[model samples]
Target: MFEYLTAGESHGPRLTAVIKSLPSGLEIEVDKINKELARRQHGYGRGQRMEIESDQVLINSGLRNKKTLASPLSMTIENRDWKNWKKIMEPLQLETEPQKLTNPRPGHADLAGALKYNQKDLRNILERASARETAARTAVGAIAKQFLAEFGIVVASHVIQIGNLKSESWSQLKQSANFDLDSKVEFENYFAQLDQSPLRCANSEQTKAMQKLIDSWQAKGDSVGGVFEIIVRGLPVGLGSHVHWDLKLESKLAAQLMAIQAIKGLEIGAGFEGASQPGSLVHDQIYYQPKTGFYRGSNQAGGIEGGISNGQNLLIKLAMKPIPTLAQALASVDMISKKAVSAAKERSDACAVPAASIVGEAVTAIVLAQLMTAKFGGDSLSEIKRNYQAYLKQLSEF
Candidate 1:
């Protein structure tokens, strides 16, 4: 099995992660991980923190000569902003008092976390609850992406809706369209087009309009949020088991997607839309080919059925709510004084949907990687590939 845990405050000295149970003999590069980290910081509405922090991962363990050692992999990313908060965030007690947060933002974790942890200052909660932690997750997912790439699986994501502006292409995809989806080359071309966009959007005009909307919100001291779609291509059948509810791939994917900060909702394929459709329209029909084995006429089920992958492209959509921290703080109460006040104003982004899409891809990659490890059951990459090839042969013969 593969699992990872992250630690550190938003403005702490560094964010650290420990990823365990990776097979040995898999090559990894620091630049690849750093590239994903850089992507997490990109977007039009990012805060000053993005400008201050240049996130780069430092691999401390579980790798030798750019290859895994079949052990726990440890990594860290320094917080460049730590210098400004050193006196305040010092490990030991400082001679002078540091700034404390008494007012809690309406939609943030400040109030709830402070109360749960029995903390007097909301800073204790905000430090760890911040979305800054996703940077560490992006690094871990980058490794998962590299691992999956060896098996010819590709995971990618792109913005679909930014507030009221929607991508016409994505809308068309939501509806049943007769297209040449059986060709992997065709889907690769589509992914390539999305890759070229700064917002990870397939439509250039919508992206431009989305940028304008973000600029407008910034001027208003407000924020906006939207939805993004994640795509996983070239997955082999039967990565997840249907025997147990906990092992269901859809459940696992939903759990990870919801865990991301600011994400309010998610759907798989024609998820909510399928609720209104008839049985024939909602379900994907199966067909068999002499060369390709099994296939689906439509992917309304999103490449998953009975908790296992069905060898079709997996599609998932996530909805992120507008960021809670406003330039002009929301109405709030001062916990210390017990009086009404404007909520604490901290530097914040007007919209993070684009960056959140990258994070969605990262989390999805991790889940797929874990499924690969569990199914292949190998101590090394070569062994995994050997097992995988044998399984493919068995499928072909079946």
Candidate 2:
């Protein structure tokens, strides 16, 4: 369930998303969806496009009286900037020749996309390739988040690194704190405070330094990129299967998270760092209690063991490369002219790690929602809840 697809382009009339499958009788809040869209635009180093567009989701089908109807849910987010580019972006033939972009940006899809589709204009390739498409995704993920909330599952993220500066990771922060990491209230409160921060980072001093780094680079006509972590809490022990490679939770997570624009790398828990540690140090030790059932003392495996969720908080880290568009563009050869030229410059952020963290939360929610639906397997929210409760009861008895 929760199968979906997004359509439309940056600067187009509107971005459209169709969620082809979802359970019935789930209540959805439009305001919450809009709130997520607003969060995606609030980061400190966002470009002028954030100012020009205030995104809102418009429901087109499969919903009535705020409840899902068990059909394909469709939504749209209008691009406020569409008015300015209507002439050049008309779907039908244009009355006059539209300007074509020949030079491709070095780190972007411009060159390869054009060559793949055999297009003369780079705009054709870039329109859909732009990260603007993530708005529709954020909307879909908002609904997925709502679904997860029904089961008491929460997904959140925070920026940990920007350029060369770094902040404590989730594991390190938990170790330094005196509170219980398993307490849902404590965990939620921590991330709630991060929502108020400009960089979505818990460390105030590091956030200020990160902002200074962004400012210095922007002044130099350069862009910056960094890393963020996604943390999921309240997952059951068996959402995925070990029988098939594709069914592994990590594989699903890596495939989806890596699909986000500008993302370059991914890590789960200790990940690459665990390579240098001995087996005894890197592996999480198992323990059993009558009240809590089976558990782990640490989560070096990132909440999954043998391709299934281990009822531990899921931890994932991702790396994003600098935005391809720059004030001083990189050198490139014009496809049509066959001469040296600077890459195309577009309105862009000096750094977007903060905004990307919000995106990470939304995306993580979507993947968990998918797995939950698969595990519970019901046509209605109430039915899924019944199945989930039964599973918990079974686990307790075991």
Candidate 3:
């Protein structure tokens, strides 16, 4: 199975990611991965960490001479602030008194995590639970995206809402999705454009509007959240299996989306909207032609049905909650003193919807690539190339 593991505290020496089961001979680029990290930090309402960290990945294992080794791939993203926090985050028993976190932030993993582990200092929970971990995840996801792009797929995301302001439609976004996916040059260009944009949105008007909404949130001295969407094209059929819950593509995709910081909800095409529809209208109607192997009239099922890809576009939506380091902290009991108090204060963004969209893109890429590797079944790029070419030939001939 395609898999990944992450380690390191939010304020520790560095973030680490180990990805396993990538096909060998697939080109792995450090610069490309770092670019994704840069994208994650570029949004309008980012916190001070963005200013402090310029994330760059250090590949340690599972790659040599720019290609996968088909083993576990390990990476490191050094925490620039680790030096200053070394004594505080030390794994060794502290010779001095550990900084105690009495107050816990509302809507965060702080208090619950500490209580579950039976810890007094909420800092033990909040340190590792911090959203900073998303930086490492984005690095790993970027590699997965590179794999998907090699197969003629295009995936990009954008912010659609901020606080109370929401956009109705981003019609211009539909124009940039053309794909002859699965190539070096195309993948480079595809991400290049996204890296250049402020909103990571294809539509200039929509991006400008998003910027204005962010400005409004910044003025409030409060935090907010918004809706974002990941749009993809050119995915083939049968990337996931319906036979098991763990194998369900949508379920796996949903889990990855929800795993990101501040993301509270996930939806696939016409997701919740299907609840109101009768079964007849909810599923896509099948069509076939001599030239076209199989097709769907509409994609309400989000390119997946029966837990597998059905040859249509994938549309995933992510709903991010407001950043939790609220300018006005919520009430909580102190872990050390056992007295009620305001939550610990931390520098945070007014909103992170746009940055979260970048995260969504990374995770979706990882899941999709994992499925593709599983279905195609190869440990090296040469084997994968032969199998993929044969499959494409079959599709074209059929």
Candidate 4:
């Protein structure tokens, strides 16, 4: 239903994206997409690139007068660092002024990627391999998030933990949150909200605690990880297919989540916790009523069961490991010397758990939008709206 590709290196001239098959006549908002790129650069532990780059979307194709033309949409987000790296990342041969990387971090794609590709310069591998690629993904996902908004569908995410001090669970916080779309409130429009507390939390008390915890651990020259949950509401059921392994909605979504940097694990409902419980206790009990279409006693399945959504909130939780680039660095062998060396350390974040959540939301939005279009395929916005309305009617009457 939806597919995207990204190009450019970690410190390349620009991060380029091409998103194909978005419905025609859908309004394109430059600010909305730029804001998403801005969000991706946020959180507690970001490096120097964030300082230099002021990401803005330059619409190259698939748009006319602020509307889609039913063609492959292309956008380029300029990397501010590109000016300095013009010679370094030039597509043409650079006379091999070797910027060779010898050390490979344990948790990164350094050594294995180079070995697999048979490349001497690890920069060749690490460029495409860097978390910097997420900029392209996040840019495209912002468009996906906009598409989701076309329906009453809403997707929101929040940080639950930073390191050992876990933040509050998503469902609970969402229940207590008060945001009026009419009023238009948004966080993460800035560069540094990572210290905004325990959950990278916007809440005052929690944000303060998270900041303290980060400061406490900063001295050890180590980084911390955190948990975040994404909730998709107003999604009609049956967006995924059980017919094919590749077509399964959960698998596609899980694969996207795992694609992020330092993201070690993902869970739908009970996730790992459900593994310890019996079937009777772990499975969500479905109940139908006049008020709600098909409600569940508990969402242990994380909104999808048997590879298809069951009309419940699509809840997905992810656990991110600390970033591999740390000041103290982990022990690793230098590829050139074949001797032990400390992991490469550039300017890195102290904690990126919060920023990771933003990426999680972005990635999930793209997946959900893809699934939505898969089930309700249409070329134009008007046609998609008609199909979506019919689907909603079917849902309501049932």
Name the top TM-score candidate.
2
Could you tell me which 10 consecutive residues in candidate 2 have the lowest summed lDDT?
Answer: 288-297
Per-residue lDDT of model 3, residues 152-194, tens digit only: 7777776666666665322223334566333446644654686
Best by lDDT: 2
Per-residue C-alpha lDDT of model 4 across residues 1-398, encoded as one tens digit per residue: 45988888887788889987789988979899988887777766666667787788898999999998989999998877766777778877875585677788777788899899997777788888888888888888888888888986766677777777765564454455574222223322211443344345655666677777777777788777778877776677887888999888889998999988888888887788778989998888877788867787776777787898876677888898877778888998888778888987766777877678878888999999888887788988888889989988987986
Span of ten consecutive residues with least summed lDDT in model 1: 168-177
List the candidates' TM-scores in order. Answer: 0.96, 0.99, 0.89, 0.90
Better of 1 and 3 by TM-score: 1
Q: lDDT of each model, Cα atoms only?
A: 0.88, 0.92, 0.79, 0.78
C-alpha-based local distance difference test score of model 1: 0.88
Per-residue lDDT of 183-291 in model 1, one digit per residue for the tens?
6686777766765576777778889999899899989999999989998988999988899999999988988889999999988888898899899888888788888
Tens digits of lDDT, candidate 2, 160-210: 999989999999998998887679899989999898999999999999999
TM-score of 1: 0.96
The true-versus-predicted C-alpha distance at residue 93 of model 1, in Å, is: 2.6
Candidate 3 wrong stretches, greater than 4 Å: 93-95, 168-194, 202-212, 277-283, 394-398
Error of model 1, residue 68, in angstroms = 0.3
The positional error of residue 358 in candidate 4, measured at the CA in angstroms, is 1.3
